[model samples]
Target: MRSRRAPLLIAAVVAALLTPAAAAAAAPAPAAQAVVASCSAAAWSGSAVYVGGNQVTHGGAAWRAKWWTQGETPGTTGPWGVWERTGTCDGGEPPIDPPGTEDFPVSQAQFNQFFPHRNSFYTYSGLVDALSAYPGFANSGSETIQKREAAAFLANVSHETGGLVHVVEQNTANYPHYCDTSQPYGCPAGHDQYYGKGPIQLSWNYNYKAAGDALGIDLLNNPRLVQTDSAIAWKTGLWYWNTQNGPGTMTAHAAIVNDRGFGETIRSINGSIECNGGNPAQVQSRIDTYLRFTSALGVDPGGNLRC
Candidate 1:
């Protein structure tokens, strides 16, 4: 039996988009390579067909096409897949945006533009404060790459929260069901405390525990902090964005920095649910939002916009 993909996103994100990684065992884990390649190399494209010996960069690594192929994602593609692991390439380090806002790549005005109707709970200051936790959030690669990533992230955030209008999940009926009594730690904060909350709507006791542990916040017993503190809420969102592999082999951060395109970000967030014809409407919605955000930021949306 296949293991369920780590539902590493907000309640709304998981429920609506993410699903199991039924083929997790198929690919071997990709390791970072020592022979660094040029950061300026063109990244692999899902839409373009490749023949033997063609090369591209993806997920911080260099890859060479073993034979003719198309649409096979790197890193996650198995050893038998058309592409072979070459070596690690320079993905880039944190670079400040043109906005000159300390560390966050998105300017306050840009964020406000993206979510003008956003709840007061989703403060710009709160998000900026959370940037320290993951310097790589939108800080990797070229300025255009950085802004594109920022747009991709916020686009999904907008979709999950309904343009940042809803801070919590609309369905309170699913609240108590997120707890897993089998977890040795159980639900110290009561069975219903782990309901969806914050910008992306976190839920489930295990997820709260995992996010809390990573951020050094005791959320297992005080899951409501995600609902009360805007900074902490944004931290959870960043933690998932930077660290969790979600339904894919790489994190969303890796997807953008490595030039795997925005569609890989969608796959990382939602498994195959909204991709591969599972839900074209949802995929189109995300792409539309991403395009809007990228346009607002004055950057090209790049290739492979769909999953």
Candidate 2:
């Protein structure tokens, strides 16, 4: 996770891309050290990977492991727990493009051109790592599904935060605000509750609490923590993505594909009208963002725009 202050700076970068003068004026920021690790099955020994940093290592069987920065507990260790079974790596289905493949107006190069900064935050390798860590989406489909879905998620995030850099920054800010005024634990004064953070822009203390609770973190006290912690923010996003109650179930990508009214899905997640704000225009903007991404990917918009 990156800091919200970072996105304020990124806005300038985005502006630079829009104009030659801005680009000329822009100075690159210092790059952070990238984290890397290698692991092997033999490092595991024979014991399960604990939630903290403990693991079993025995003769011949070595399960190498690394820490997931975001969702760290005293006992949790790796992305995939040794006790858990991930079934087959391959589900045997040939990857197929979703129904409206022809509606997309942009080529992959054009998509890259539109969001060149995305490569800075999330590379293809990072997305593959995310998919690998999240077992629920591991068998989602073939490479096509992985690519398209990752692109869609990235597209939505790009629109929400202006780009991955912005997402990282805003997450650092922890998007303070209170969508639910009736609650006593609403956002503090002067904090822009609606600003939210991350690609989904999760706003409001309640949402923070809920997301934290789902991911087993104390986000209410440290909302900004999501910015510096990738695994935490990623897991929080995944929890929201997989949960069914809000904005429909986390599994409702097909509904989104059908172009169904997705503001309702967002509303379901937020449990408030703030998600829709009773404003058709704002809702439509979000819908358009999704459509534009799909269209860029050469997919149909699916006509479910009844927001």
Candidate 3:
């Protein structure tokens, strides 16, 4: 008989096995309002607006209409959207280049050697497409930036959902239960109550409601929409990347750099076994994945890889 178990994704393995507790514990105590808007989406486009008790300033002169908004307050579930861009503005000041791009150059082969299975779910072209859209995510222009972001994503995803294909499949299977429970967007009646599907494994009724609202879908009642529709899953990932807490709140990169190191960032966003699940080998595996992924991007292993 065919196996009934659903496949895993990068998010599931990371969420299930990595340890983020120590880093989370050591993180600087959150301010009364732990969620502060860093750069206003308005700042990106030069248009200004006041939303949610904050002044949003667009950054780019050419992309003046661009701005960011939180779906909800800190510790709340919601999705973020980039409504428009009137003109272009530099998102932020560019970072100084790190030393030694010459000594440690990354290659596609290296990436495959480490994450041999990435191609199963995300095509090389697809990964490149994702990266090109958000060059500033890890820092623009630098190959190291791409590598770090890719590595971090891969490591965390592997740890989160077991593997890329698995995540997609499992997400498809458990679509209805996502975000329908004690958690704001959760369904307690479902298989896992919080087994919402997709790249970030979006769970909780509030989260589904917000995602549905942002994407203009009614996910609360039809959680399976994410699985049946690949576009929905991709949109959900982008939403998670942009929204979650808020713009510039606590990025996967920043979280990694805080308590332990870059590796820890992978664990935090991906969720750690030790911290979230209580497993050491899983944590070590995450570290190993990080190292291998970095090598592919041609970055030296010990460089100051920060967000």
Candidate 4:
């Protein structure tokens, strides 16, 4: 699963990074060999997710993780933290939103109507607060298209979260596998930390990294922020809706905005895992929610309801 990211204290930082990282790119270094530093393991990155048995070189020392970890500085997370002090690193490198607020089609009252029994963690204010991360979301097309997009997004979220009742993934057994060790950064936060959280149930270390990078949040290290911070949680949902295409060829936003139909949005979210007769019941569940949401928004469900 993927949850991209949000507006929090991030509005200012997100605004600042709207352009290129010119200054960072132009930084000077010592002449060739003098500037080179070699390490046996990769230098720790705050954005990376690391798991048990992974090693990293930091502050001239080598450290091994006792379990999945992230953002825990090699020397910092305390002796009992996930990282264990290994002798010394052979070598390693170490180191290193918001568009605007505007009126949204779905009112707070209506949102409540959508999920009256929803968990308090999924706050209406949080969703409204996260609007700056992707202003175009539910605002890029005609009134009908806008409503459809809103409904589609909320519908999927409702389904994923069981009407927003669950804040994190229920099946803990599958948690450890979300990490992709082959990725250079690995899962810095323990592999289990990335399991589905927030409204979109953001999962996977890479998705946290990508989403955090986009929103200027260090999600890879603080993945729990999704469950604890309502605005961040909503932003992750928007991040997936507006940007990630997932298993489908186009983004869910594109699916609705480009007249591609609601079915394509489903394809983009979990098509490879749940579509095309993969599980007809699940597809129908999503479709049923979509239809209900569209009706609430006073919009046509549109064609192509199946993926």
| Per-residue C-alpha lDDT of model 1 across residues 29-144, encoded as one tens digit per residue | 89865433444558877668899778887767777777888766555445887767766666532222333365555766466556756788998778888888888778888988
**Better by TM-score, candidate 2 or 1:** 1
* Cα lDDT, model 3, residue 261: 49
Weakest 10 consecutive residues of candidate 2 by summed lDDT: 86-95
Indicate the TM-score of model 1.
Answer: 0.66
> Highest lDDT, which number?
4
Candidate 3 ranges with C-alpha deviation above 4 Å: 1-135, 138-142, 168-196, 212-218, 245-249, 256-260, 270-273, 302-307
- Using all chains and alpha carbons, the TM-scores for the candidates as numbered come to 0.66, 0.44, 0.46, 0.66
**Model 2, 172-252: lDDT tens per residue?**
354343456676766543354345655565666777778878766777767765554655655555555555456444343
**Candidate order by lDDT, highest to lowest?**
4, 1, 3, 2
**Candidate 1 wrongly placed segments (more than 4 Å):** 1-100
Q: Flag regions of model 4 displaced more than 4 Å.
A: 1-102
Candidate 3 local Cα displacement, residue 164, angstroms: 1.4
lDDT of 2 at 117: 49
TM-score head-to-head 1 vs 3, winner: 1
| Candidate 3 local lDDT, 1-307, one digit each (tens) | 8867656786587567656885476578757643334453433211233244443332222221124443211111112334322223345422122332222233333333444344244433334334433334444335555456556666656555554545444545565544434555346345443354666666667776787787677877777776556556656655555445332245564443232345445434444335344665666776777776666465655443332
Local lDDT at 219 for model 3? 73
